[model samples]
Target: MCGKPTARPGRGRPPVYCSRSCQARAYRRRRQPLPAPGSPPAPRPTDVRARQRRRIAEAVWRIAAEQGLDAASMRRIAAEARVSLRVVQYHFDSKHALMVDALRLLHEENERLAQGRIPYDMTEPGALLRAVLDEFLPLDEQRAFALRVFTAYYARSLTDPVLAEVFLAAEQPLERLVADIIGVGEAAGSTAPGIDRVHEADLLVSGAVGLGLDVLHGRRSLADVRTVLEYHLGRIFPDAIPTSRPNPA
Candidate 1:
């Protein structure tokens, strides 16, 4: 009867495994890699190659934002993105290359957004001035964050010549746009007759960069910053503003 199907002692509590190996097998199946206390959860493993490359880039940006550029290493970025060191290296050949790509991506995105917001043509001197100057302010949340990221990258570029080159590449379109505006101002006879166009164009770029940085750092309000920019524009194009009452803001 016992061999046929008799109930064993402690069967009410639980059935004993037939052998220790079975129990060991069950425990092994249950084991998993657990995150340590206070550790962040890991990213999922699906489509890991494409996803981890993007994640590593974003992690580099976040680390740069929080801890500064010196701390944003390829290994650290891979850890933050929760990918293997080989993955980040696979995506980018080296740490400097990774940083260069990341900064280039950021610069390209910023230019795209800024370009999208411009509605004025270079032929329209006054309108072009307003459009170019508009980008120098944090008119909305996206622009505000973009300005922050731009300033961060610009500061990092001081120590990274390759990054500086990438940044200048990104700025070429805007510089050309400025040159076009200066040409319009010259054709319209609005700009000072004696002013050197090339020098003035360079000055305008420097003014835009400096004024934007000042406003970003809270050294001046947007209204005050606009006034300063208009002052520079007026110097460049004395006749651009009509003598009649300007439009209300």
Candidate 2:
């Protein structure tokens, strides 16, 4: 006599397949396609990290944007990612480490967006200046959020020396890049006559920070920031005037 089929353990439903043999028999009956041997196995998607890290980063940014940096704590971030807090902590050693990573990610994203769009040749004048302006202006949602998070961290850093050190270190590359661009514009005769490269770089960084703060505080809308940048660009690098040499007078 054949053995009777038993009900499944959890839901109390009859087993679809009585045993391993039954499963194999059913599967064999269903035709399945097999790929050609040398066809590279469908290339196995290259975006695994992109999917995971992007999800994590999106959650981090969303938390940062909506709740501010403190709200982006490990547990909060993990909850946002729908993962265990330990998982978030495992990936990043601490809140400071995570913040550093977030900032670095934001920096990379901005660089990617600004690359090639910014001209390499300073001799071109307006084009190079526009590139510098483009980086400072938060023209869209992504840029806006990045700048917002950056500004938050920057503010937090004022009292936290560790955070400040990290923030300033991250900003050094950008400052250097700005200095180089200013130097080029000055050399190319595209900047204002009396503009000091170091001084101007300082002013531009301050202005960018101010613009970001204004947008963050509702003092100015994103569109207003854009307009302000346009106005400043025109004043800073007027097409009619030649770049002025530093005067001894």
Candidate 3:
């Protein structure tokens, strides 16, 4: 007999094997017993603090994106994560700490996605420049959310020293990377003659940031931003300018 209990009185034909699926499962189990529950369930794999931290950080990111970073309080984040308030506090001592962690997570994820999109060869300085700068543009939902959070934090950093330090520290590496790429372009003669690579890098980065904000605010579209970037790149690398004529079919 199947393990299921019989239904009372006239419910049905005592429900043999629960259903066709259960009947099949019982037949299979009877043929070969299950592999003895693997050493008392192997310690149950607890959620651990790392997972909690990631969950809390993601909750903060979502809340910050949907309703400004101002709304990402410990209580709100805890509620969003379906965990107790103490859990959030346990992982992050302060709201600023939580925000910083969230920002770091978002930055890491964006960087991974951007790096995946880049090509291995760096021969075309113009193409490399476009690829690098294009990483900052909010052309999709994930990038848009990242841009929003960055802009929000940047605004806050203007008035808060701690956040200002964090923002500047996070930006330094990117500035250096862009400057290096521009230096490569200049060396290859793809960039304009005698151009200040560092200053040009700063200009490109600042422009991308500002343009990203504009796209997020609806003042400019992704296409518009790409057009501007193309024009800007052409100015630095004349050979990179795209033709105006449409390709023939």
Candidate 4:
């Protein structure tokens, strides 16, 4: 394991040891039998279950996005996933249960993508806030598909109490996060003075989502949405410069 430099070989055989001590150590290691590693770790029941659940949820996402929420029936989901109906039932007991699980998984996936794009220790809270807002745009197919399905779920939530509960559960926490970021920027003197953090955050966050939905439905171009947000964000931070950093993933 010592990474010391070794003597060069004379073009015939390779030399691995630079000195007698290393040679001795290598020899001893070669002679001594290593303990058997046994077998690779088996998949835990929970892990297998989670994986199965994820596959089913992704099927739901695709079907919901391409067709509609009403089309994502339990049997259709099973067929889309190429699994038996019983297997789908085993993983998700009912269509309502499946829809909830799929929505949660979608949020987890969206968070994972944003986390990957934004560094955890990004120093500038303003930059962090900007990135978070930018993520709502449908800059690429993956996000566009996600937003499409999410909009369908949102419409369904209007009549479905269960779905509305899921949406509300996530919305408050997200608004609080955006507000916290704005609070940090305000403390750093980067944001406009005398602004209410929670109020500003609510407007910015909801506005971004509203813009995204419009863009998703072809009512407004993505560029137009960007321009509008830029104007608003510039007003909030007059001293800050705006950059069009499109994440086309």
Candidate 5:
């Protein structure tokens, strides 16, 4: 007998398989013998749950950015992901959990971008700062969408303790990285003396966040934001030699 349990009675013969597919699979297996012990195992199937979760998270981010965080409900996310509502619920217990997961995904993406862009050598602090800060700028459609979602989530975190904890935890690594860069520059004599490394890092990060919001809201163009960021970097690393500025177009 097939192992799967049968459904409740429906005034018909009791079912031996859950469905036609299962019945056919059992028949095929019965007709074939198992492979030899030394034979290589079958390849593992792709992880559907992980794939579904990622799909759902990406959908949530797009909806949050385009329509605001409040619009990113489980039902809406399911619709956007082209999955059933039940599938979304199966992946996440609630909307809050989905949001937290989506935020984590966004943070991971930001970290990837930062790691890829930041130079291995920290001797050039001005260039290093520019590279690090550029990761947060909304210079393209993808970055702009990410910024919008991050800002929306951050604003929500102000009133939600759980989100606040998650957000603050995610921020720690970037702050530490910035501080370390500043320290390295100071050691190399490329940064201004007597600078409060931690405070400067905080200010730099806060400035980037503000500038990203401004660009998202069209308060300033990306080029203008880049110029402002360059000016701020100059102030922080006054001793560092200036590099040729890029054309702001």
Candidate 6:
């Protein structure tokens, strides 16, 4: 900026600007990479890519939920997502890769949203654990859609090794999280003594999954499932207390 020779600092990166004022000016210029004033903003390459990818994944989820996985061909997914077949092919090498990525994104999104929905005032381990576990059920429209998609993929995974790998990869970690919370509740004297949290986690998680499927199949009512869960909770933690929360449905 000054057009004057400034000696480089010994043994360090060379300066881009001669002085702090020059550095600030350069920063201001770089900060305006998008547009000047109020002209229509330019869509960033990375943002557009992410949006497209998410759109494709969401298309997979919706189709799997409403229709069936059989309907989610590459061409169909591209049409559903409003992208070209070439774009879908470009992002995912094959339909299997696309389905796997969509499942992975679904799990990541479920975990993020579930954690975010936890009550900030829920300091109790039992309460937090219940909150987390409740996410597995098809209680409301959002969770119902999620569980619907999950169940469809799970059924497909039974015969597809690639899909099985994806399911198994994410399953154990979630069980461990539940067991850890149960252990905390036990240590805090809010749960029954001498409980094997790992075993409990396995049974609890498996049972919840089974019940969720039942609910999805219309074999059980939402209230009935909640009642069953509460009964089981009472059996497991006689001293555990309840917290005021929104309807799980």
The CA lDDT of each predicted structure is: 0.71, 0.66, 0.76, 0.81, 0.81, 0.81
lDDT of 6 by residue, 1-249 (tens): 557566698988877666554555456557666557988767886797799899999999999999989989988999999988767876676789899999999988987888787653435776677777687788678888998899889889999999899877987787888788887777777777678899988898999888977888899986778778877676667866754555544
Clash number for each model: 0, 1, 0, 0, 0, 0
The collision pairs in model 4 are none
| lDDT for 62 (candidate 3) | 81
**Cα lDDT for residue 191, candidate 5:** 74
TM per candidate comes to: 0.66, 0.66, 0.75, 0.78, 0.78, 0.78
Best-to-worst order by TM-score is: 6, 4, 5, 3, 1, 2
Give per-residue CA lDDT, model 1, range 1-249, as digits (tens).
112333367547544453333444355446756779998876665566456666777787777766677788777898898977765665675788888887877676666787788876766686676678778677666666667666777888888899899977777766667777888788887778787767766777778777776776788777777777787778778766632324222
TM-score (C-alpha) between model 5 and the true structure: 0.78
Better of 2 and 6 by lDDT: 6
Of 3 and 4, the candidate ranking higher by TM-score: 4
Q: Model 4: how far is 29 from its true place, Å?
A: 46
Q: How well is each residue in 1-249 modelled by candidate 2, as lDDT tens digits?
A: 025475568766667765544554356447445777887664443474355555666678788788788788777788898876654554565677777677667767767877746767756655565566656656557767887777767778898887677667766776667667777777868777887777666777778767866766778876666656656666656762332423211
Model 5 weakest lDDT span, ten residues long: 240-249
What C-alpha lDDT does candidate 1 achieve relative to the native structure? 0.71
lDDT of 4 by residue, 1-249 (tens): 358877677697666665554555566557755556896665676898788899999999999999999998888999999887766876664679899989988988988898798754435776677778878888878889989888889989999999898877866777888788777777778888778888888899899999998888889988888888778777677666687576332
In angstroms, give how far residue 124 of model 4 lies from its true place.
2.1
Cα deviation at 214, candidate 6, in Å, is 1.3
- Model 4's number of clashes is 0
